[model samples]
Target: MLATAVESTSAKIIAGSDDLLAEILVRSPVSSLIRFKCVSKRWCSLISGHHFSLLHTFRHRRSKPSGLLFRHKPSLHPDATTAPESDFELVQLNGGVSTAPSLRYFSFIPGQSSVSGTIILQSCNGLLLCCSFPFMAGTRRRYYVVNPTTQQYIELDPPLEDGTSAIFLGVNLAFDPSKSPHYKVVCVQITLRSLYNYRIWIYSSKTRSWRISLESFAAPFDMVFTEGVFWNGAIHWINPYGASLCLDVDRECFRKMPEIPFHQSNLAGKSCRFFGESNGHLHLVEVEGPQTTQFQVFEMKVDYSQWFAKYRVDIGGVVAAFPEMIHSYLDSGDGNYYDFSILGVHHEDDEDESLLVLNIPGKIITYNFKNGNSKELVDFAPAGKDKRLMPQLGCFDIYQYSETLAPV
Candidate 1:
């Protein structure tokens, strides 16, 4: 009887150990867990499941972001500074606050070139939706959904039929791996002739096809660089008139959200405003003062009807913190000099530590909101050959991206 009890206790201990191991594996980074999936069939099933993916995302979100992904596409213009053979390049900036961060070249799945696209439509769940080069005299555009980490990609066909005259305004990716492996590629395709020509097409991975709808208000007037932001089961883009264009991912329908309030003067510049998401809420970064030194960040209300002023940052503080660093804009001969504008904000895991990435006339500065300190992140002029690049100039597109093992 004692021998039998000993064997039962040992079996219980073994089962407990297995349970603990599974828990630990689920918390591991997607890149590491993906390789472990090959260990056994059971491990593969567990690691690939929606639940595991969700857990992994949540855990990683709590940690500092891994690095930034930079996409460079030189201009094809005759007068552009870049060469015609300037093949598209994707760069990875890998490191956290602890390690020395550096940029490295990344290779896509062989034979595939990402630079063919005009804009990186959207990035969701480690997958990127890029709008391909215009074809048929700008009448059609192809989109490629790619996983940079895995170097795998899938090209999505045009969502319209033959002779359906339409212009693709903007594209966004809706992918929540915790719900399913399948994802959705959404585009705002507008037929210019008609007042009601604004429509949205959603491409479903499960169906392997596209579906278009015109169920909501007219297409948003402004679907520029402030691409759609995915939040609360919907994708959102700022409308120039005030309201926002929202498309429900699950319901596959379009709706209007309240307009974002911006200072009247900010309406002057085409690239004056910026949109982003942080801690599950939609935020807008607006240029406040004439000098552009002051910025007001607003967080959308939970109901999506209003905005609350969240943080107001004075970039001039950076000048005081780093007195030795000379800003080019300070020497402008024009009496009216453009002030530094908020390009982006990188929030840290602790919530208290966040960096306000700003753009001056000729450089980039990262100011720590928590510590009230600042440092030069990059200079557009002489930092390096690849420095000072912007998508509009046909140079490069830079955004904050996390590293993951999300397969194409």
Candidate 2:
């Protein structure tokens, strides 16, 4: 009788207000909520509706944007000396047509920032955490967290006087929009090749002080710094050198995860390393490699110990379409492909289950997972085609529900 009444309360709350439902459910027991969703059809639908799904996406799918920093000549004067501007963007993977011709992109330029350049790392939740080295010599470098949509930014004081000489550094950003007001930031450092030289530091909102965590890594491994994706209870990073390891922000300790399967082909001679968050867990995808990516999708399963083949795609000549290109793989495990909100409905299909390979040359080409179809979008590319410029590889992903939300 009590279970039935509690279930009724959940249903009423969900039907009343999504924010109210989330606020109530977030603090409730996860097991009880899972059981409540299975109580009745109306309850199930309410929990699975767009609002509930979006709240779930924010809880589980919050992610950082991925982009590259490169030098480009804004003008076409053979000897033009235009200093390179950091071209940053976020790639949201869509489950609909994979090879959609036109792509969507969000550009990031440091506003009124003293110095900004291409981003090297990101934390989920659409924040590009970056290092902007001084535009001039002998100056300090500033680190920033910028929300591309809102254009709101937070800059950190420069680290040790000679940050250039520091051996290893990692930044962990916590995304708890509930109490954080602003997410918490942590900076980790280890001396160059010095054992037991590990240190953890955090910038708090309440006290506005750098607090060092009590926990530490006994023997830190070599790190390839990217955004530490916040998931489950800890944040994960790609430690490609050996097995994967993560930090428990609450506990502040590093723990190893099951190894991600690697193919000989991927390690042969790829130029860039690739890894992305789909749903939640971490997955390593092929960025650039000798392997002719005959298969486009693979999953890091269970606990990152094995790889599962999900789907396959080919852009054909699409690589030649744009002067700028990027590839970021996103995983679609939600099983909600029918909700075409943005409705990449640019064109209709002429053939049954027939996919369209990008007719032009460019870096990215997506695929329609269902019915094996593809389409091209014109909106998310460089403005006006310049025949001379070749779009080099950058980052790409499918649009998810969280990204479809009003940008901020």
Candidate 3:
């Protein structure tokens, strides 16, 4: 039996077979091995070894373990001249003992640019997606996608020339192991010109060129990019503007997934944005309307459901605060989360004392809905007390990853 073998091997590892035993032990069920690590120091060292960590990362889905990227709020709105993003830090959210995030690391300096009122994000696969805040003067704004993990960035040219109103970009990062480089971007531009123009643009890393996607959706209002997350080779978005939509990058297609099942119908109040992936499907976190506006997560089980309620967010007894009109759900996955200042991290709290001013109770929070349970991750600083409001989440959603699945 597997148990008999596990017990036998558990007693027989020699000094010279560390690598072999480590590999063998890693092959065992993770929960079982993790339990054995508690049985003795030798097992602890073996399980927590660098090789084991790398193997776990290679086999299972592990966000860069560095920690969650804590985003800060602007004192006067991002557009204000006085409150430039002078410095920002990263806070590793510890889930073992407490949900409270302690400052573990940081990047102390001005964020990528001096421009005020820009969108900021800690993307999955370890990148910070950002853009300059728009001006009333109506100048075309610039955008940047920086991967702090690699210290590399792509500053996109101003979005499709929307000379009249405003244009915002949301990008999804996908990697196709089948391709040479395997990374692709699905950038959707939400612009209000004569109508709600839902334009999807794509950037192929292998081709090293950007092109207009053949796919377009009929959005009711301008579209907004959900958090740029990689799930089953597509990017997802919360379409409070129309029906919820998802874009597939490899196939270059548009399809409407299930909508969040909140009780109310007024699209104006529901703050639904793409959060992260859960159990291999896309998730939309919605700040439900009117009644209490509590936050909830809706999981899409079937990619093409034509609007069905898949699963509900099971919050583990924490207050599900709604997203302030100015902020939305962010997709910052541990190490590879949103990084600013050309990039950012989470370290000491006092390292960036300004963050100390950010209250953990307000602003926005992260929700994890798995195993029929939802747990609150981090509570960012509130944005209303002394401040000007910036364009937090607006007509942008779904960054599709171009990566393909291996042979079934």
Candidate 4:
């Protein structure tokens, strides 16, 4: 009985040591941490505290992406009668398995039911910026910032305007737990009077309110504000027509990014295949012709000075392995098409460990930049009966997935 009592006392001492307990808890997976909250009030407070969340984020900041959330394109059939079987599918990366939250997770938000039509706009860190459209006309759309891992969310109303007609451009989420536990949502709106003039609205979780920025700026012609990636303490909006635009979130000011180095002739028929921030790096990929099997991966310098080629990617081996990726067109004059999309560029501390995630036809594969080898990550078949009516899997929207215990 004395030995049993001694062992219990030792366990209590270890549990009472906040620093030691936190060191162990920070290394635990988010799913386990969530369940650990029920152990006791002390454990609950420690795990949910902002300081602990920040520490956990810093510890796992270099972790590879857990998975990807793929939002499938809507049906294109003229007489479609029902919604697709599944609107979203989570594809695991690096052979890791994780649970994907469904629309039911959003039920906690007030006045939001039947969230089938809701769509994910962006995934920053571990939070998701989602939009839910009204079922009836004239009802204002709603925006939400959700932490799926924690099953917590907050609804945001549309930013108010000054009585002038404006088109809502896009909203992006910026969350860096290492810097602050709070997150910010950025909204862009353009005045109908001028195509180049744009206004910025920012929502701070700390303030729990939205405020309009005093700095209104004009952008280059055809410069799109959508898909602005937050990296290096700024949100960058890539422009194919001219110089891309960068907004310093901290300073609330606009700046021009270095011009894309590609010559006009090189980019004439090409498109921005992938533009995203991963592991503190911003990568851009462009593909020219339909059958093009070669391209360069460009990485932005840390100082925002310019972009340089990071990787010379040749996907000829992928085509040779997966013949379904080669699309032959008999009726058109255009050459055979290469069916693939660059989903992301994952950089690791070890340069040789870097991988380029790609989607080809019905399979998701990761291509090693160093060895030029390809490995299939996930294989999925088309959902509907008529495959031709469904859009190519590569066309689906892909969002990075990372687990976090940060509160919404």
**Which candidate gets the maximum lDDT versus the true structure?**
4
Candidate 1 lDDT over residue span 163-265, tens digit each: 6634456667887655656788777765656655566777888899887755344653555523677767788876554556677888777666766776455
What are the per-model C-alpha RMSD values against the true structure? 6.0, 12.9, 13.0, 3.9
Q: Which stretches of candidate 4 lie over 4 Å from their true place?
A: 1-7, 14-24, 38-46, 49-55, 58-63, 72-87, 96-116, 162-167, 330-335, 383-390, 393-396
Candidate 3 wrong stretches, greater than 4 Å: 1-66, 74-86, 95-122, 133-140, 158-172, 175-181, 189-194, 215-217, 225-230, 263-275, 278-280, 287-296, 302-408
| Candidate 1 lowest-lDDT run of ten | 97-106
- Give the TM-score ranking, best first: 4, 1, 2, 3
* Residue-level lDDT tens digits of model 3 in 1-408: 999998787666644577776767755654466577787788788776655644643454432224444334432333444424433334433332222122111121134344444455424443445555554474555556554432335666643344542244555666433232336667767544436666777776556667777544556564446445566677766544545566677788865565456554555665333355532445554544323323433455664554343334333232323233222234343221111110111213232211101122333233332332222334333444522233232212111111111110
- Over the stretch 158-181, how does candidate 4's per-residue lDDT look in tens digits? 755576333467688888766777
Clash count, predicted structure 4? 0
Order the candidates by lDDT, highest first — what do you get?
4, 1, 3, 2
The TM-score values for the models, in the order shown, are 0.71, 0.54, 0.51, 0.86
Error of 2 at 57 (Å): 12
Worst 10 residues of 3 by lDDT: 399-408
The CA lDDT of each predicted structure is: 0.57, 0.43, 0.44, 0.74
